[model samples]
Target: MTVSNNSLDVAVLEWCKLMADRNDKHHWSHVVTDAAAFEGSLLTAIGMTKDEFAGYETAMRRYRDKFIAHLDSDAEMDIPQLEQAERAVAFYHSHVVEQEAEGIDLHGLPATGAQMATYYHAEERSAAIRYDAAMQPVAG
Candidate 1:
């Protein structure tokens, strides 16, 4: 249970980072030709329309900025309990996981929490590298 809870915390934080990064104009400007088009592609790939993605991103960013990113004195962030975290994971598995999977059998075998944590860490590291590469000034 502890492992699962820790895994959930890591997953949530990873997702928060993804949301925050995607919404950042600086990050988007570094990689894509048209930000809106790139965002639309991302939203479609994630099984959400532009408006839906906007609402979800807005909420996630609010929580991320208030709680995870800074220790804002006046920010009121509602941290989810373990039960809520479990429910969120279950919900994602049921609804969102399939959409994200591309030819991979996500439901075939469940990975342990430790495995997931490692995977998430690797993914974050790779994403950071990609972001840095995109931001580098191109030689003429």
Candidate 2:
């Protein structure tokens, strides 16, 4: 196989989109705060306070804005911890999706965004390996 690496990775951008703060971000907002729901935030279920998790959310937003959303070189910063981001996503699935997503039929699907990305990476890797093998020259 000639090609050393081949993979599509847009996880950070997608994760940032989910964690972003916007009026249209209904599900995320509902999980993060009680602004839209009469019940309190689901963040507590994950053993995190709004203030505690806000930093992670903010980091994702900044990463999205400065890097993925734009080429703002001056504002670019380090990505947030993957474990923190994945935890937030998992919490959303359990607290909101399992509780409120009636008739949505989320069964057989990965529970978190990180798990979904794993499938994408695996598929891309398989395709790349196949392509590399196919392109190998026949022995003279």
Candidate 3:
């Protein structure tokens, strides 16, 4: 892997290299457990199953390969679902990073970023309703 003089080439090549599945020890499988990707283990963490993950990965690959990396004949392309990716990352963080790597405390964060997002969204809706009820017009 020789270093390229062009900045853009460096960035693109780095991504391509990372995405390639040489299946060596550096591969993601070395860290991500089947149970973490599929089901609950002793950690009791939950995430997308292998099939579900594959679907998301396929969508992303199409987007990356056809949409971003290069242009194809297709006028439209399927987008990767970010929420799905987020859950997978969250699972990986808890399953591998926190468990395997030492001294990384994520104590303040929610189990999933989605949980915090949904919680705040719901809170906004609830607050609006409460405010509306309190500010209701009184008829004498």
Candidate 4:
């Protein structure tokens, strides 16, 4: 796949994982839903205004609900989702930097969505390779 294709696949896969985890019986959805509920606080924490944060959230939600989860027939995948994902990833990175600056340790935090996506894509590629190898004719 081309670089763009690989990046898009990673974004779509990451979005799918987010949706699944968020909707599962476990309290994962709390991460996103709860954060959204405290939009004011989170915005302040992230150094973003409500409008800027809303733009990011809207991009992600539209991509998730319309393209990833529901697959709305009228909705077409767009660059906004990719842009928003990159922005969100950067937001998280800033938090990490801030924590480090404050002398706080982050040994147990979960990997960022972008990191998870890379790991998932690697696993997928490995599985495909194994499957293809298994399907090869035996050289008796």
Please report the candidate that would top TM-score against the real structure.
2
What would the per-residue lDDT of candidate 4 be over residues 7-78, giving only the tens digit for each residue?
A: 565675565454333464432244433455444544555566868756665666666677656768874576
CA lDDT scores, all candidates in order: 0.52, 0.59, 0.51, 0.54
Candidates sorted by lDDT, descending order?
A: 2, 4, 1, 3
Query: Which ten contiguous residues of candidate 1 have the minimum total lDDT?
Result: 82-91
TM-scores of the candidates are 0.38, 0.56, 0.46, 0.40
What is the Cα-based lDDT of residue 44 in candidate 1?
Answer: 52
lDDT by residue for model 2 (6-100), tens: 11115556665566555545436544435444124446555667777677678767766776578686743675566666665666655544455
lDDT of 1 at 132: 75
Q: Kindly indicate the candidate among 1 and 4 with the higher TM-score.
A: 4
Question: Any residue pairs clashing in model 3, and if so which?
Answer: none
For residue 36, give model 1's deviation from the true position in Å: 3.3
For model 4 the local lDDT of residue 90 reads: 49
Score residue 5 of candidate 3 by CA lDDT: 23
Q: Per-residue lDDT of 54-74 in model 3, one digit per residue for the tens? A: 565566666667756687889
lDDT of 1 by residue, 1-140 (tens): 44444554575566554344655543433434555655555655566666865666566566556655676886466654333333334433333343434446554543444555567579768876876777789999
Clashes of each: 0, 0, 0, 0
- Give the winner by TM-score: 2 or 4: 2
Candidate with top lDDT is 2
